[model samples]
Target chain A: MKLGFLVDLNLCMGCKGCEVACKVENEVPLSSWRLRVKYIDIGTFPDSSRNFTPLRCNHCENAPCERICPVSALHYLENGIVNVDSARCIGCAGCMMACPYGAIYMDPETNTADKCTYCAHRIESGMMPACVVACPVEANIFGDIEDDSSYISRYIMEHQGGVQVRKPEKHTNPKHFYVGGGNQTLNPLAHQRIEGYGLFNNITHLKHVGDPHHGILDRFLAPFAAHKAVDNKSFMDFEQKKADSHDKSHENEGGH
Target chain B: MVEHGINATNAVVTMDAALPGIIWGWMITLNMWAKSIGTGVVLISAFLLYRHKKESMPSIRWIMPLISFVALNVFLLFTLVDLHQPLRMVNIFFHPHWTSAITVGAWMASLFTGLITLLLAIGLLDAYPDCARHNEIAKTVRANSELYEKFYPFVVFLAIPVTLYTAVIMAESSARELWQAPTELMQMLLAAFMAGSAALVMVSDKWSQEVRKDLALVLAMAVFFSFVMYMGEYFFSFKSAEAEVTLEYVHSGGEYNVQFWMAMVLGFIAPFFLAVSTMKSDNKTILRFAAILALIGLYLAKDVWLKIPQMLPLS
Candidate 1:
């Protein structure tokens, strides 16, 4: 049975308990983490409210990362857990740009990339992923999608499942099934920085748009940019305008 | 007062598109700074080479250490851009989406760093041109000197693009105005070539006054062209809504104002003066200082250009 994680944003209280639990359980370096809680503070000051959503890897069906590594450092196990073999990673930082979700980060200790693995270590030992286990709000749901008895499966079937996926049309089919009204639709621009631990405490977004032609030029530059390999997977969906339009409506609708 | 509200609203809409552009433009800043260092190194080398032309090539045994030390500072500059987890720097690789500028920049920087490191090692062991004939570090360096000659050009070429990649990434982004230059690629190319020539001249030995003057004149001309191109791009970005917001931010004297001024003086004006001063006296020191100033200013401009555009997005 293929494993997967279903994060019901509706239940996530922005408590960051999952963020804390993931760190302590993983012995993650004090400065970084595998899982993070992100909040989007929309509207101007005073009228603005915080929109919190716990974020992690979706164990993408069409994983962009596995396609780009110069060496086969990251792999998706048969059970469908996305994992990294640290020995193979060369500290290249190639995969960070491939992920639309900004889910992965380079581990400073090993100088290799690190992101949520659905807790393969704990899962093999018969324990749930740390975030799933420590989720005081029970907002995170993890299980095998194929088995009808699996909670995630039952949950997906019972409720209208949504997700914070890349423009599925862009081809990275994120398996992180989102619940209704969670993540005011998927918008990376609105994805602000996680606060606390020094510097700006507000949930700020990225520095300004560095490349306006990103939606186009990035694709053109990809082949010529670097030596990183690419998987010629068919990306059946890539409508930047559509995603942008949908994002506009989604944010206008207020907190999901 | 009215503009602030307009800016805040606009920021909300384009935030997604702009963030990556900002991240990638940083590489451009580093490229600029590195070039500045390169200019200083070249001018100094040029002066020394000119003075000691008749003597055996004076051993710049100290160059190896200086390169390493300067490189260390350059390394730290890249590390300064992070927010939450600086150690997770490699995450850029594990999550590769080819479209992400930061990811692409990370790869370029890694490759560039690797090459620089190898060059450093080769230089340290003193293994350039004559290793095969004499079997000594110095001889190897002399024998393999050809190898380094080849290596230098290639690295120069790669470094140049990596330098411009920053600006190109910026020029295309909808986020910041300064980056959207219609002529950015060409502008950067002109600057890199001019700087490259200056670097070569400063570091080369056995050259004549006529040769030095010719190279200096060419570089000055290149600087003039680059300035024109940049001005054009600067104004081009100011005509749009998103771009205009960013353009206004630059004029607002955000954190980058002083940096921009420094770049103008050091990168453009100072070198111009230094190069011109050589016409008055045959002194090498003034020329060296000019070369250093020009290089520093070029880097300053690159950094300010990349970073200042970013400060405008509402917090």
Candidate 2:
């Protein structure tokens, strides 16, 4: 059937609804994502623009992960969907090494390699992928690309000259296509990543133990507990004072 | 005045967390290093046996298998432990995917180990005939020298692929620009010879000086070529941007700078000089020292090469 995905960058907003929906639908563990929305700031402060790109597995025709998987845990489904059988996986992380797009992740819970399977279960049940359903702007389009009547095929036909895939030089021949996406947005290497405390950053805090509040008691009793503890009253007062001062300065500038 | 825009790069990833650093760590390094020793001994020992004949080296038959069996076990152990689903490793055998180099390598290694075990048993029986005389099976096997000869060639042939398959796996790894197959294949082969010869020198204290000299020569040649290849990549990796970025970790004052250079100097350069000196002066002490250094250096080199490439972020 040659199932394919298309993400129209033109219509996509940075809302990340699809990302959340996919996580919720798949029950993807904390800090592990089947789909992620990346924000790239382009140009100078005054003339700058931000690009929002939803990145996920491309499900290449010649999949490197499938080829490198020792146990055939990752195999192509009958409908051209690259499916993963986590039960069969030995968790060698070989697929992680072979996926150029960094789509594959070792599930912290299962300790097995997992990736976006184009929502194969949902596809078999005759439903669209969760990401496609959740995309408020209808940016994500999923259908059988081989069928000329399918939406994805028509989309491909419409954007024949403009369609792009990530890392085409790798010769993966990805079934996923992007329309109206710039190089800076599609190409991972085109930008320098900022390292700091942000969403999906600070991975040490994302350790997926069974208990949600497992280490809280231990952390509270640990060495230098008082020193590490936040003084909420003092911090709030300081923040209030800072806000007041900032308002005064802005008012003074306005007066001037 | 343009404050923010001037000289600023067009795109900066303001939000993302895709960096998975150094997934394959020291365990993989140890796996490759030990595997090299395991396969290398078989390869070099076969050559030595062919040159000197089976009758002359009575101790070598048992000793070669013993070394190979132990080293291969270590290799297999580390490989097992490194896997997140080590208990599920039986899947590789039962539900094997032949297209994967890892699958092929695993099967070959298992078969190779099994054959090495058989050889070890035969060698033990042949060496200690008095002890095993009551076991007619041992006597029958020992009597049939041709059986040993048949197994020897298989070990030799299997050793080459068992050592080289890792390179194919490395090459197959997507976006790892530093691990090109042809060069990696050469490096793996050279490493096998270097490690094999060094190991032989360490164990072959009782063997003839001529044999020792030949081992030293092999060690020297292997070191020289391997060093040249390393240097070639070190200097000229800029052809590929990703490789250049990866190599940055091993560049001067980089994270792996000291380790990489130390490996090159200690493992390859030092051994080359010592091996040549041993060849000329027939100095057993120098030969032994060089072999020790070479083995240690090989481990360090493998560690540096394995780790540095992984430092570069794929996404």
A97: Cα error in model 1, Å: 6.9
On a 0 to 100 scale, what is the lDDT of residue A27 in model 2?
75
Which runs in model 2 stand beyond 4 Å of their true positions? A197-256, B1-7, B53-58, B132-146
Summing lDDT over every window of 10 consecutive residues in candidate 2 chain B, give the lowest-scoring window: B1-10
Model 2, B139-207: lDDT tens digits are 777787566668899789989999999999998897677888999999999999998999888887788
Task: For candidate 1, write residues A1-256 as lDDT tens digits.
Answer: 7887777767777778888898778766534557776545556777665556566777887776665544556788988877887766544444554554556665544445777888899999998998888888787888888899999889888785454443454466767777744323344433333334222343234332211112223323333565222211212235744685688866644421
Can you write out model 1's per-residue Cα lDDT over B71-102, one digit (the tens) per residue? 53464454433222333445566755455444
Global local distance difference test of model 2: 0.83
Q: Name the 10 consecutive residues with the lowest summed lDDT in model 2 chain A.
A: A205-214
Tell me the TM-score that candidate 1 gets on chain A alone: 0.70
Candidate 2's displacement at residue B171, Å, is: 1.6
Error of 1 at B30 (Å): 6.1
